[model samples]
Target: MAGPTTQEPVKTQQKCVAIFALLCCFAVLVVLIFSSVDIWGDNEDGITEENCSKNCRIVLVENIPDGLYLSMDGRRHLPLSVGFHELLDQAKHSVEVVSPVWDLNSWDVETMPSTAKQGQLLFQRLLSLKSHGVKLKIASSLNNSAELKTLAANSAEVHFVNMTALTKGGLHSSFWVVDRKHIYIGSADMDWRSLSKRKELGVMAYNCSCLALDLHRVFSFYWQLHERDYIPSIWSKRVTALYGKHAALELQLNATQATAYVSTSPDLFCPKDRTRDVDAIYQVIQSARTFIFISVTDYLPLVNRSFRGTTVTRYWSPIDEMIREAVVLKGVKVRLLISFWKKTHPLTFNFVTSLKSLCMQLHNCSLEVRFFSHREQKDDIQYGLNHNKYMVTDNTFYIGNHDWVGSEFAVNAGVGLVVRMTNSVKDKGMTILEHLKAVFERDWRSRYAKNL
Candidate 1:
């Protein structure tokens, strides 16, 4: 009897202990779940309507979880492909795109890797969005577009601005504006190479209406040149709307505030005396306090280079003069990352070598050049373009369409997005300069890069 009584009490105690433990675990789990969540949480993945209202200006790719993507260096990089479609998918009002070549065939020609498959799906979604009556306007040269025209007839419109007619050159700008508020300014074209195989870079301007609209002003200018009967009276209205003389605007990207100079070339639609894209590059390079990092699909300084297998001054450009001055006089460290894609000029190699030779002779300044070639696709049709046209100084960042080589670069109308960090602190404690330098250094050291 004594033993039975003792066992019953012991069982009760054990049950009570177990129940207490379960309760504590449940409470801890609840606390942990709530701890990770935020009622006013800011979305770092992409800008949503909710996030935009709260002034989420920039969406950093590499900072977020799983943002790392393996680039040419076999090192992980922040993916440019992550939020590209998320913005497009979230667009409710309009979609505007500007690229040198808006090749539509890329989506369906073949199955691509996951990133490019996403791009293909994005194109289809855009068409679907257009069919559903979302306003779609594309400012691209319709090269192979019996299909694009047909698709446009279903729900969208393609307005081609002939560069030869508009500026006696070509159009090489690649950007997108969604709903007149979010803008993507980068080096990727609307081609298959851009989406899948090419390593491209740009910033997504979210919840920044002023910058988007200013870039749209450039779009409006080119869109006016298309001569569409559907919108015949849009010229003067667009011109009046876009024309202005405001040099820079007070803009905020999340917490980083800066004065952004929205510069465009030719000064056709807006006020006269605007700094052309090339001129802006010159200014940035000249004003760099520490160093300058340049990444271009093609880099031809306006100097004497062997053009088409002949040594000539046809490439002599004032921009080249400025670059030389930066190295020869100011002692600025210059790192060049140029791409070797299909249709590249053979003279490009020799020209780069010449630059190296000149820099080798200099003791005051230093110049380094590297080439970026994809690891897998030299002999295959899967090769992509390294079409990145951008530069970053100590605190300033620029994304432009022009190649910066004066003669070969100025063949078309180009646009530049110039931004600087005015405040001492970076947005969310991550500097764009750091991000750029990390990426540049990785490419510079990657096995894909070649020294001149």
Candidate 2:
């Protein structure tokens, strides 16, 4: 070979420098786009078309067992699996999902039960997203998730958040933000039980880009924490919420005016302009003038933590106090429907008794507690539990991922959605608030509910 000229080496060096400069410019542009206050949504007095939309349609989705039938109401909500499939089909560009569990295949056993069919179908649909040229990104805290690993190998992007190392918690959030326009937030996880065996409730909002954008910010927050063990001191504005409790997005749901916002758990995860999960729950309870119906799998107001090597247990009374105040001081009728399962904590009953005692001698106070029990053919405590975590009042409805446990609010990573309708009563169609209230009433009046 002939010897290379010195000018050729200089030309290669110049090309390398040019590429480096281009990359630097790209990085600076990305930073500016994310950190700029004038970017993303409009900042014209905090209300703009970028973060607010009209004529949005929101539907309530539920998963009830075939045997578990409530009274025949002409109104039947869409099934949860159907809702997920619709979102999958509507996704054009990207689909971002955050769930703690990813066992949709249900162990992939050859002799899988009939209940696993729905989950299996959903899993296949998720895998098909890549073939359609849609970007699929998933965030979870599960370390040994085989499904996630397989998906990651097949053109899906997966990120793991170390909740245990950061806050001694787990990622319990379950939501989907599709194409930055549609969203689903609820108690159901990406599991087989949530699809068929367990009871799940969620809301699917279509053509609501404002609310979906806010939820996508939350997903971005988790996506940024993929390989980090500690939270950053300062976060980029891109992950911050565009609409929160005070500045909710005004939209028309089923032809009725309503305000909606998304909330996250464990104050530490809530960036600027984001509302905490507990505060969201409190707002719903406080705004209830007539009644407050709460249904959760667990309702213990105690926080258990390891402090400097020793275990400490203390009463975390924010929500507990809020319920008591709503019942006694605000004269709001409070009804709690807690699930009774093998994992029911002993302290839960004691707190229920204490809450019941507040209305014992008072005439205005109305606090009632009920335990919802379900029977299954197989003795699997983990499968048949009522996995609902929501609160429906007279005007507002709140759907969340965390149970009413103090530790869940204190440390776990979850999300909550609050939608308050202004003209819910006068709307021709049944509002989401009324639908959830009816569902609660059905569960409350069913034979499975037992009074405390």
Candidate 3:
């Protein structure tokens, strides 16, 4: 019996192991194929499948779906550094940053490193990057970053765009594009407060060429008018060249899938049919399948109406209506985290009161609003404002400078980034909603938050 085909059993076992190894190799090969071809080219762009990866080779969102950690007690959480530095570090040819404010000296405040030393270190890094032959172009309201400019005097090209003159308000976007391939958009400003003190939320789009191209055109809205405040005569080309194609609203790589819309407001970039940040927020709110969670410093939606050419601002609360519909019509849970600080406009509180009263009429987790404030003890250094401006629906997340209003969208130059993490949103690891929920819960339960 022992001699009766014992060799056959061993040969079968060897075949099984060979099959498993081949499957593992096949799995890895598939992952590499998709990762390398994340960015798609227009078929007519003469990009054959063989050469597509060679030209526009890009990456996908790989970092843990967390954000730049904020530390009040100087105990930095996961992601100890502002991840933008990593983007800068990887830039090979160019780095373009459009920030409303830029101040290295702002890092000189107490707590972590000596403010001066931190500023110097950051400045040295900037100059070093520039010296390495990277074309560092910064469009900031750098009217005050004299120290930063001194270091990059010979290397970086610094331009100050007076946004108030270009648009109705000053430039409010704090975003950066590295090599015109990736983007980092968030509530954090370029100053140090946004780095470690402020409650900031931002998304890093890795190898998101379509979204990055849209934002690049948005940046061009300010970039072309360099050192000038007037719109150029042929400015339309700048937008048309980039946004002419029908871009995809959703993108995927491997098992990870994300839907994104790169939006800007005041509607200055494209034609009449283009998407605006205000409308994007309404879409996200109206499309919520279960819950809507929002954290913003302000929440007053005002529409400017013109009667016989005289413009008058009227209170328009579409977001409030969305909340009411989500609660009353769809039975969706709505929770809003609004920051109440000294600078909070008085009228915003009135609107909040109105919402609270409406919530009193509903129940079953219909609507809940919380106020978050920095606890001002005797001399605990003033923690930055809860300056985050973002909203998360059950299946989507929107982050931008727009404050859920028409006025900020109509007057201010701002941006909104939308990410749709559909059914697989509960995947736990890099699911955006999972990460956002954690941040919202932490803020909602903090000692500073009060349910009013």
Candidate 4:
């Protein structure tokens, strides 16, 4: 009778272990479900146009040729050569140039400089178009308050919007729409420094209908807020509308050939529950297969090390999580080209070192990360910084100005478009891949193989 009682206790323990195993499986299933879908509702607009035609093809340009000078010496000088003028004229006519500054009085046209000295000339042409009634709008960051005021005084119709107020981060995206049919996105600002000082990259696309409309929507949203001088409580409603509703989500997900994911900061936008787009980036990292190429201005978070002091634990940082997922599980190739500059935040240094350590850890894991600095004759050029944020995966591309770093609670706002391409529809995939590869090669050569 004593032995029987002891056996009953042992059976109870076995049952407890079985139940624990079942609970673990259930937890795993829940995680898988959340991660598989765009849980934050950022992808709601991605599927709204499923029946929309895939009419646009993305053309990728790897690197702008060094000799491709658009201006020189802060003057409005155009190219004397026929081919240069032809291209310049085409861009001037076809592209609706939007910039923070277009000062005609600043142009010194007497200097017959090369194509590089045509900034003033370009500005003059754009301003002249405004006189003739070509629709053009200029939106500037509040940081350029002086310049904005000057332009507004000169009848430039400039709108001053504090991006930090709207998104908790500075404005950093430079783009132009051409004929409402093509979009140009890059790191180059509409300034002399962008043309010659900074190492920048931009992609131009033609006939991208869905992306064009999306861009228009974002621009219009910002423009509306800018006009009213009223920052919206929530910068994005597309996400709020699509989450938890399967039918709505399905409609959006199935609408277009390419998916769109919106990234915003909760600090600027008032919401009951804040949503961060880093989660979308994590999903992208996990889905990457062939290659992952990142062109970022800053790759490290503001906080460094696994633990700071005693109470702070940075073990689960976003950068760490990204590295682990991209390198450990995916078996995917990773390449990062980040700008290196002196006098940056101390935490950046630690993050850079951490990145280096991660790269070393992945030495046998098929991951490569490299830091890049632009090589120019002037010492000041080194400090110009690479302020572009873009990523290309297999055939998909993401172009934005948001730096992916910091905590889920920290918000860095940016605006850009994500477009998916296939081989059949205009060969945008190949174009992007080729462009990214070329840029990477050029930077690599400049950094490591300059003498070669």
Local distance difference test values of all predictions, in order: 0.64, 0.86, 0.63, 0.48
**Error of model 1, residue 185, in angstroms:** 1.1
Candidate with the greatest lDDT versus the true structure:
2
How would you encode candidate 1's per-residue C-alpha lDDT over 1-452 as one tens digit per residue? 79998899899999999999999999987765553343212222343323333233664332111222336344344456666776676688788888776553553455544444645665676678765567888876554666567557767777777655444555667778887688887776666556666666777867776666656656766776684323222233322322222455655666766667566764443333355676667767877877888888787654344458885666555766766788778888888888776655677888777666777756777878887665345444335446677788887777876776665454456777777767777755666656676677766776767776
TM-score of 3: 0.74
Give TM-scores for every candidate, taking all chains together and pairing residue i with residue i.
0.75, 0.88, 0.74, 0.63
Better TM-score candidate (1, 3): 1
Q: What stretches of model 1 exceed 4 Å from their correct place?
A: 1-56, 60-78, 104-115, 228-246, 266-273, 302-313, 360-362, 375-385
Consecutive 10-residue window with the lowest summed lDDT within model 4: 244-253
Candidate 4 lDDT over 70-97, as tens digits, reads 2222322221222122323434323333
lDDT of 3: 0.63
lDDT (Cα, 0-100) at 73 in candidate 1: 43
lDDT of 3 by residue, 322-419 (tens): 77777777878888899887656777777777766765655664677898877532122235467778888777788897666567776667877777
- Clashing residue pairs found in predicted model 2: none
Our tally of clashes for model 2 stands at: 0
Q: List the residue pairs that clash in candidate 3.
A: 108-115
Angstrom error of the Cα, residue 155, model 1: value is 1.8
